[model samples]
Target: MSNVYIVEDDPVIAGAVADHLATWQMQSRCAKDFEHILEEVEEYQPDIILLDIKLPYYNGFYWCMEIRKTSKVPIIFISSADDNMNIVMAMNIGADDFISKPFDLQVLTAKIQAVLRRSYGTALSIHKLECGKVELNLDTTTASVDGSQMELTKNEFLILKTLMEHAGSVVSRETIMERLWGNDEFVDDNTLTVNMTRIRRKMEAAGVKDFIVTKRGLGYIVGE
Candidate 1:
């Protein structure tokens, strides 16, 4: 599943846009904390970001720049600020596409699917896993959210990717350690703990909350 992050402020519009993505069987999230847009971006790590021009604290352009600094993910601007100057500004800041207000939902969905297909190689991929607004580009060993990218340490990426690929299912620590062996690393219990903690901090700094759930003695799981 492809994860999408929405940065629009209007509740009604945001809900509608998210609903549209869901209908297509694509997973999506509306930004919950505007001041921490980057955090939200990291937490979700969406394949694409639907950003509105007018936002709280700072405009979409500022957030776009912040995201651009770390990722090459796709960003699509969606706002009533459809003026030429704003559109140009959005594009110049690194947005992949622009969808003006009063547009058709079907049209918007089509555009989203197209962007996803192009960026992700296909619209729907089974081997891959998704969480928050982030997509683990399985084929590339990279992670993207709202058009931004994160340089994940191999161990860090592997653990989280494993959990997400099996969202709602627990993955044992022993299994995780075994997987790490493929990279010539023998991870002890504490080693896995350190890695998990670091990964969690990174995700938290990116604005995600309670994304990975610990299953007591069982291991970890990406909660649904």
Candidate 2:
């Protein structure tokens, strides 16, 4: 499922947005610890973020810029500050879209869907997977960890995507090779091993430790 993070501090508005998003089969979490919003976002690794202006610690613009340093995930600003200047500033600060408060839920949902499609291609059904602090963008074929992003080769991206999709499950090497070969890549055992090693090195260099764990004869997994 697509994950969305709601950074609105208002409990009522946040809860309402979360509920409406749930109806659309999107998983959402409202921010509770505003003090460490960025850390929470890194952990959540949302596909999209619904941010609000005039927040407690820092405004949406600040957080949006902060998130931009680490990720290119789509962010849509939702707030009562509907002035042209505010909207312009939000866009300038890396916001994908903006919506004024008291807006129709259907309209908001449609906007969210559009942004998701625009940012991550037309496949709104595919989810961006996260393992610990690392987030793999399936659409972009890229991986981000601790604010640093690395472009993954097609094979490498597929391998990480498969493992992150199965998270704790032991994805057999045969299963991964099948996926790569199905993409017309013609991957052999050695090629798969090479790709996995490269992925691990890139991830570790980006400050992701122990991201992919080898299960000896089994396969590989993101977590224990």
Candidate 3:
């Protein structure tokens, strides 16, 4: 679940794009306060951004320049201002890709996916996995629940990644061990238990309770 920050001002277009992105398992946040776009970008920490050129107070060029000052998050301009000058200017100021208005939703999604693959590297296109309020940043190996983030050990991240990838169902302990060590034959079963305990403790410390649930004979389930 890669988070997208859409900086379009048109309510209809923003809503349409947000809804469409949701179908691809991408989360999107539309900008509300145009005057403080950079602040919102920092707070959201989106994997990519969809920026529009003509805005209320300041235009997309100004916002793109401001974002370039601090972060390297990918920004794609989606605007009706699709003239050659606008496109060249957008690229010059660090826009990853530009899509004109009256575009196909599917094409827009494909472009976003391509930009993400390019920006984060092919291996990291799926930068985040989310379950309810819990979000795991695969690139950072950190988990955040309700905005409180915690550093995860390599084993902890692998375990959580496996479980959250199958969020609604139980993942068997044997399967989790296999994922962790690449083979269940040599790894100690108890190691998984210890890791689970630590994960739970970390979750509690971060204000999440029973985020991973034991199904007795079944393994464990998150967001169930």
Each model's number of backbone clashes?
Answer: 14, 1, 0
Error of 2 at 23 (Å): 0.9
lDDT computed for candidate 2: 0.85
Candidate 2 weakest lDDT stretch, 10 residues: 179-188
Per-prediction TM-score to the true structure, in the order listed: 0.55, 0.56, 0.57
Ordered from best to worst TM-score, the candidate numbers read: 3, 2, 1
* Candidate 2 lDDT over residue span 1-224, tens digit each: 78999999889999878876764557999998997889999999999999999899888888999999999999999999999999999999899999999889768888888898888786674547787888876545578887688998867877887788788899999888876674455555698888999998998788777888989999998866
The weakest ten consecutive residues by lDDT in model 3 span 178-187
Candidate 3, residues 1-224, lDDT tens digits: the string is 78999998889999988976764567999998999999999999999999999999999999999999999999999999899999999999999999999899868888888888888786546578899888997655689988888998878988998899999999999888876665448777889999999999999988889999999998999988
Candidate 2 clash total? 1
lDDT per model vs. reference? 0.79, 0.85, 0.89
Q: Write the per-residue lDDT of candidate 1 for residues 1-224, one digit (tens) a residue.
A: 67889898999999977865653456889998999999988877888898998999999999999999999889999988899999899899899899999789768877876777677775454334577686776544566666576768868877877787677889998877766553445445698899999877877777776778888989888866
Query: Which numbered prediction scores highest in lDDT against the true structure?
Result: 3
TM-score of 1: 0.55
Question: Once model 3 is optimally superposed onto the true structure by TM-score, how far is the C-alpha of residue 183 displaced, in angstroms?
Answer: 48
